[model samples]
Target: MNDSKLECLLIRIDNFSINRTEILLCIHFEISTQTMLSQSNLNLPGITQNVSKVLTIYTGGTIGMTLNENGVLAPVPGQFEPRIREDMNFHDPTYLPQEPEWLVLPSLGDEKRVLYKIKEYDPLLDSSNMERSDWKRIAQDINDEYKNYDGFVVLHGTDTLAFTSSALSFMLQNLGKPVMVTGSQIPIYQTRSDGKDNFVASLIVAGTYDIPEVCVVFNHKLLRGNRTVKVNCEALDAFNSPNYPPLATMGVSINLNEIYINRPPLIEPFSVQLSMDANVSLLRITPGMTLNQISGALSASVRGVVLQSFGAGNIPSNRDDLLTELKAAIARGVIIVNCTQCLGGSVADAYDASSEIFEMGVIFLGDITMEAAYTKLSYVLSKHAWSLQDKKDMMKTSLRGELTVKSAKLNTANRLGNVIVMEKILIQNSSVVNSAIEEAISFDQTKVIELLLKHGAQLTRPPLEVAESLCAAAARGSVKRLQSYQTAGVDLSLPDSSGRTALHMAALHNSVDVVKFLLNHVDDINQRDILGLTPLEYALRNQSTEVIMILNQAAKS
Candidate 1:
């Protein structure tokens, strides 16, 4: 083919992705009967499919509910079971079918069809009424049913769904089976309800995908069950899996997004704790919160208090009276948990009054979300009337994946906790990597994103840490780390903590790939860092051709 024709074809394929029709013609350039017929279906909407082997467990939701005579859109008790038995059509689950499903795709001859039968289960409820007792029962039921099915689809109410999910992530432990919870805002019977897509996608997702953990499928998004929190009370996409990436997401095809899956041994067995013992209290400090209010909440027989501290865990510095009462509460065996008032900060016990409270006996909740604090504390407190050794174990350990252990900022760290401290460890541990900055330079493609992200760049993340990684990577001249940054979406043109991009860092050290990746991504060829030296200026002054080649490529791009 001529270059022009090939380019046109490439453009067309890019614009409208190469379907089987396009693929057949591009590869063979001949029309056959099968290819032509297959092409015909590509544009068709809503084709009823034959899901021959998958099981759809309908536990009731807006998907199976309708408006009663009183006009409330509610689950019609046993309606979910009949809907499945009546062959009421729906799409397959998000992931493909499983067995007791394994990680691999089904055998080629295995049914392109689904075998959905009405689960011979009991009635479903709107999740608002879901108590911890109900959660215990649901976990038990799913555990019992897991071995016999291809996958499970739970129709849950949007409200309180997060709580049930967090519970299941811990309760079920390591499920090789895919357990999915989903629901809709509008009733499935309503003309414009999002029920069909949400329900069908979750069903297909549960059956087809290999993420073997509890998850919530809603509004075309698949959230890791433990990490997710229902943020909106009324929207269709009500949940956000805070501090975690989605395990998978729904689209034309299910996109499984998990980078890793942590599982305990199934031989370990599924046992229900059934209770948590945390008598938690939340104290919201305003301009004039006095000792009286603090004493009232702490003295009210509460075993725990989530002291909502101000900036980085600060409070009124002069209010020794309130601080004294708080200390007394701590002496009363009250587990005071200090969480920052700022949405993004932590309680340092060094800032304002927050530190004094921390000194008084409050444990740092760090950046955990407020909804999580309430539910987790409630669940923990409910485990028993008293905080036992086991209850403390739950808090320190990440039960339900709610807390971070390693003290690093999230998404940037391969693990959690203390970004600065973590970076030094990641880099210093790079015996092969030699430096933290060299975190991702090994691969030409793929894992580069994860590596560079693990190395971390900045945007509101503290500068003291970035300076350390920057100095370390620059000192080592790690090519792999540089390349990884490109894939990880680092804006190469931007300045670092010391006012240098990798360009300037490369010029100082004469790194070829580092300079090359930087120049490729940075728009300004002659850009300078805070030191006012363009990378080219440094390359020329240093007289390194390798560094010069990198600068040239960056300039050309």
Candidate 2:
């Protein structure tokens, strides 16, 4: 359901400049959306002033409390999303209009109240009482209802809200939507409680932003769910987003932290995962938590353990039982990651006892929240029985930017290999990345082949080299310079280093030109890179998220 002419015209183009590459992008959308992937060009009008569009899911929580004549803190029927809409009607005319798609989910039935309107999912209430199945169910409903909308806002109780938020953060895999989980420090019935401002602000932010990563937008602060900790018990700014920056800070006018919002395309394919390795345990290293206790957790079929070390990731040097068990656990392939109990400080593997833990094969999660470390480790272990190599690789990589990676240089500071690879390539190609396609606009039809050939690029490599380049690009995220080698002129299928070719690199990087050149001159978008990676696989791995957003966008033209 794309209004193409309206959309293309909205981009300020009066006519289609049939480039060797652009024709492919246009064709990609026409075919993909017209066919199966359901992807389309989401070219929204540029906002001269702010307007909000949001989908609010009202899951029963303490945030909406109002007292009955009995004076109990109970949830009001449906004030979360609707209240904000009503408030905006009177006070702030500048407040953006939102296309409200609000759904009231089943409520919390405590000793005080028996609710009717609240739709109980599974009849099991407490968030700590939440199972992985419940997590998936909530996420599934959110996806089902809000996938087409701009952003999502969920009203949740603060008690175990972090768990559901964190689980949803990991569970929703590539959840490229703005989600704000907020409830009240006081119920809606309270005359002076903070729920109104918090609820209003959460919807305000959700309606205006498109942060793909899941975050808890509470009080006036935005927190990465996995990084968030409910520090304050009774303050207005009840939750603090310590490790990460707030996506937006609302004031006289909304100040958005564009740096934190999803940097790539929005309409991309996402496969949600609610499963986690349950064989994971957390060991809070208190003075009484013996080495025997540590050993026992490892012995309990725990494939991974997140060690909450004292202060700056310090474990008890005197505790031989724990050290021995930790070492033995490593030998047995159990991943031990040391995270700090302190909220602010980072984990140091360079210090005395801390440094020694490194030698025992314990991975250091510097400054990462224990929730992040635990959930991330569970994510890692659930994949495969990790080797020492895999363990080290997992620690080094960014699983949702949980840890800050240190590199030798500032510019080449590699974080997630696959994510950074082609993004960096785009930076390197900034001189011509867009211009290359832009220039192709004026070229004659026959000149497309000549211009592409003149650049010493090729259609595609043999499947083998296509695979290799895909790996290198996905891992390093930057392509080593293309070589005008002996086999440069051969069929696009010739596989190189990691079985990758030009097509593999192009699509993965969303190098529109490379993608276009391959389409116009090479064989097919359907062809795989060296490692059996398709253009789509490269898009997912490289997170060229929005590049080939219209799924069949690459293949058809």
Candidate 3:
């Protein structure tokens, strides 16, 4: 049988609801044709012949749980695979990729194809019972199958999903493929379940994008694993990244924020670290806590401790016993890392209450989540080759974009030019006027516009003359400048003198990012310009492959 004939057979089976035996027979049959499958027939224009293969590691989670004999939801072994195989959405004959072949997504206009397999773990575990050994097993599994698949997905429980993701980010050094960890608040057996959507989105992202980081996908947002936290217990939107923005968002279309994603070094080889020290402890300080309570947490067996301090890494300076116990632990070679109790601020030594702890050799963790700090401490302590100071130094550095160093303010004057500076001087020296806002838009200074707005400058539509300049920014491929104007409340649908919107200008210049942004915000993408040309026509005329793909998807939606 040939590829086309096999596709035809699958389509017939799908339309008629044929027997499983026939589908199995067709899957087992060998193809002996030299005729290649063309991209046009598959509706994918730029994809290659090789299909992307994703390996899903299903470690017992709420996503696979079903009602057991006791009449309560539980992780039942050997049930998840059967459920997926029986569901039409997941196992439809037409949707199934030709054996070792590609399966196109109908919702995406058949632009991308994915081939995936599942590997379920034995003796399923609740997330609360997960330990360091389980993390080591998951890491080794990925390392063993690194060369066989394009990406990986781990279906995990929501409770410790963030910890597992953070552990994998450090364990899998120089990772080259996407490793997405996701699960659901509800089980798959229920009528109203989120598992199906979360799992399907994760598979698509893993197969298509080159994120190359440990990420958690939930409720349509893809977040970096190390930066994620379980924010809710009952809501479907369980995870959130408070300090960092999501790497991508899944909606009517997958919008990738490429600027924030961390790209690995191209020349480095992927490796896994299996040894993790489990001798770490975390302490959360409360008011009027006894010294014995604090000292007991730092037992002799513990090598590292993550101190959840009060407000900006502060300990009670008035209480000498608390400071003495911390200093005693440091003297005994215990590595104490200071993390903030708040959800979203960086730790600093500015407060007098926090100065004593800094003086006693407590390392500051800036904006590092508690989950990340705990796992990172264990990871670094397991490196027996590095010295004590080296381990402490690595804690402060950003391994896997977990932390960021405080830096000086940006030189806004140099980047924004003299027009912005003059506008600022005018605003600070006198009352705000409409001409300043117009000048800011003319000079492409978004910051100046924001400043004017902050100082009581009324946001009115720019005059007809500056509308041409708005389109000019789009043509120049300045997404940052365009975003500034959008932030300043400029109407996105305003037409230029030539009747061209920003989308038309972006399409003409082949500005892929700008085109995507405009498409997301523009009300009518099919609106024709004065020349009767839509953005799609402009993209087609310029042969902009990326722009055409985005616009085509938008048109389909």
Tens digits of per-residue lDDT for model 2, 68-110: 6887665555454455434432133222123122221212122
Displacement of residue 497 (Cα, Å) in model 3 is 52
C-alpha root-mean-square deviation, each candidate: 17.9, 13.4, 14.8
Best by TM-score: 3
Per-residue lDDT tens digits for candidate 3, residues 274-333, read 998998998889999987788787878889999999877887789888888888889998
| Model 1 C-alpha lDDT per residue in residues 1-557, reported as the tens digit of each score | 45775665466456554466545444332122123223212222333442323345555555677778997776666665444433335423333333322222222244234334445235576666776677777776676665445566676777777777776666665465577887788877667877877766766666555556777888888877766777777777788865666767667666664433433311123445555444566887889976678777787588777777777777787887877777887676666676666645445656655656656666776656555565566667666654555655565565555665443532344333234544565566543222323322322233433543555532333444444344335434555444454455545455543345556657756666566555555677676543345778767765777777766765675
Two-way TM-score contest, 1 vs 3, winner: 3
TM-score per model over all chains? 0.57, 0.60, 0.66
User: lDDT for each of the candidates?
Assistant: 0.58, 0.56, 0.77
lDDT score for candidate 2 against the true structure: 0.56
**How much is 310 displaced in model 1, in angstroms?**
4.7
